[model samples]
Target: MKINIPETDQERIVIVGGGFGGLTLARKLAKSNYQIVLIDRNNFHQFQPLFYQVAMAGLEPSSILFPLRKTFHRYDNVYIRVAEVTGIKLAEKRLETSLGICNFDHLIIATGADTNFFGNQQIADKAIPMKSVSEALFLRNTILNDYEIALSTTDFDDRQGYIDIVIVGGGPTGVEVAGALAEMRKNVLPKDYPELDCSEIDIYLVQSSPQLLKGMSEAASEKALEFLTELGVKVILNNRVVSYDGEFVEMKDGSRIQSRKVIWAAGITGSLIPGLPEGSVTYGNRLKVNRYNEVEGVDNVYALGDIAYMEEEEYPQGHPQVAQVAIQQAKQLADNFKKRAAGKEMKEFSYRDLGSMATIGRRLAVVDLPNWKFQGTFAWFVWLFVHLFAILGSRNKLVVFINWVWNYLFYDQSLRLIIRTGAPWKKMDDVIDEGERG
Candidate 1:
């Protein structure tokens, strides 16, 4: 099938993935001379930084997502297609997606990254990774469902399996999740499940590295560790989770932790598209790009965000796969497009380090700005302000702020509800088959 985008006299720019990079680029160039086609698996743009908050039941998933069509309703040149890009026809300058084939004058790949299990099929089979809104919601459901099951179980060992959680990875995601779960364990669980001892619900954060938040400053990492420890999180450093089979988490050192849920926030690899030329990809499945974000050995095709590996003077390996890097690169590429339109020379992309921050829990956080490094209450507020400001919609900002204030005052998260639904991979036909079999 062929994609049904209207033919235009202007050049077409097809962007894959509605992530920070693609979304920013499309928004910046919506009024430009080029016809923009934005394709993604989901019809909405997800705020990944706040995904943990959704998983922890602190915020709703809809609060962090904005509709793509709504974003470009006024722009006549923009078209949004909800489909997965299967492959690229580099020779034809076309894209083969699940929906149809699309032709583009220029293409931008910003497909972002997926949870990396590091070639562990067993772990991949059982462990849950919070990479998207659906995954986050599934995690929330699994946790609440486990608690429901635990409330009815009289056996101690089985109850331990139901309640205990093992989070693998000490990065910002793992730290934030651990902190949020720790908060739930302390304040929410005791009141909700009065029949069971909430203290038995151990929250273990296993990090292969020596410190939490590895890329952040030493002071921030140490402070995060301290805050998590103070909140009764069992922070295990320098320990790798080798395998998990729905019951126990086996470590690299042959140690085992019996837990039903394993949150795999360990690592990420680029979401690579097939049919790319040989030697175009590098380590971690990222596309090798130049300073102009143009993919090597490919013309009129560029890469941005977590999937692009652009080596600069300071970052010899590549820029860090963060949202800021993606946004900055997108802005630069958008400007380059405008420059090309104006018959002006395009400029090279440069990254500005904005530093990093992670919140351990309420009133406990650490921030490392370029000029300032701090920990504690002020840092926590700063973290909240930055994230709140970054959310897409004004309604989302108000809802999240109210949720935070309510949680703070009452020590409760009202969103802890188990929403049962078909898994993303399960088709309607599969559900019908299962129902018929039953």
Candidate 2:
């Protein structure tokens, strides 16, 4: 059985993963040229950079998400489906999805990336990963509930375990989460949970590398470490989280950090699908594509975003798996497709990076632009502006802007309610009902 898409004379372009890249490409494409089918497991486009904020109780998931169907409401030719694409039947240009087979003349793989546990099943089973809306919600619930559990637990060790947090990875996500949690512990938690001693809640950021934010500049890294320290986040460098059997986080050197809540933001590998030629898959499970983003061995198949590994003049291995690169590539690909339809030569994709920035806490951020590198209050506002501007809708931008302003004026985040109860692994309805009852 097929996916039940209506037959159209126009060449169909089936794009996988409704991420930044796929969303941009679908919006940019002309409705008349191709029948666009965008398929993703979720029916919403998540602003992934802000998932940390959701986990930290600073923002609601819906505020950073845009409905996939609403994204192309005006375009009649664009069809969006919420389906998990299993693999590809390349022989007939067919996609094997959970629903059924989906045929396409051109296929775009934009499935993005997944959290990298590095073959640690123990850690994977116990740790929380902030990759999606649901995952973020689970984390928010788990973190808030941990404190509640701490307040009543008779055993001191178990109480400490409920309050303490071990954040793996010192990258942007890890740093941001650590900073946010520190902020909460300092400003939000004490007032909310007066019964418990919030001051004893230790937050540790663990990184195998010697420095935090390894991809950033030395100055930024140094400032981040200092900032995190000042905010009461114990930074543990040159140590790897070897295991976490639900109670303590074990280091490579045999030392153990006692914490039940472990946040895994250390690394990411590509969310690659099967059926592509072996040569096309590269390091991090990224797909090997030409400058045009066409798969090396697959005819009329292209990949984009975090999943597309194009080794260009500027990017030898591949472009950094960031939203900016994805957006730029999607626009270029759309332009190439439109030009091809107009009987003009297709243009090769080139990424124009705007730079990178990370927010540590209130009035604390680092920005590295092409010719400028700054930190502190000024950089914080820059980081806020860039993210606010990048958000999809005007209402969302307004909501986020007001929230940030309020947060800056008064050191608080009001969205800290744990409206989802029960263990993170429990049923959704049960969690919601428990929260309501509590």
After the best TM-score superposition of candidate 2, give how far the Cα of residue 264 lies from its true spot, in angstroms.
0.2
What's the C-alpha lDDT at position 392 in model 1?
93
- TM-score for candidate 1: 0.96
Global local distance difference test of model 1: 0.93
Q: Backbone clashes per model, in order?
A: 0, 0
Q: Candidate 2: RMSD over Cα atoms? A: 2.7
10 residues in a row with least lDDT, candidate 1: 429-438
Could you give me the TM-score of model 2 versus the true structure?
0.95
Mark the regions of model 1 whose C-alpha exceeds 4 Å error after superposition.
423-438
The true-versus-predicted C-alpha distance at residue 96 of model 1, in Å, is 0.3
TM-score of each: 0.96, 0.95
- The digit string of per-residue lDDT tens for model 1 on 236-303 reads 99989988988889999999999988999999999999989978999889999999999999999999
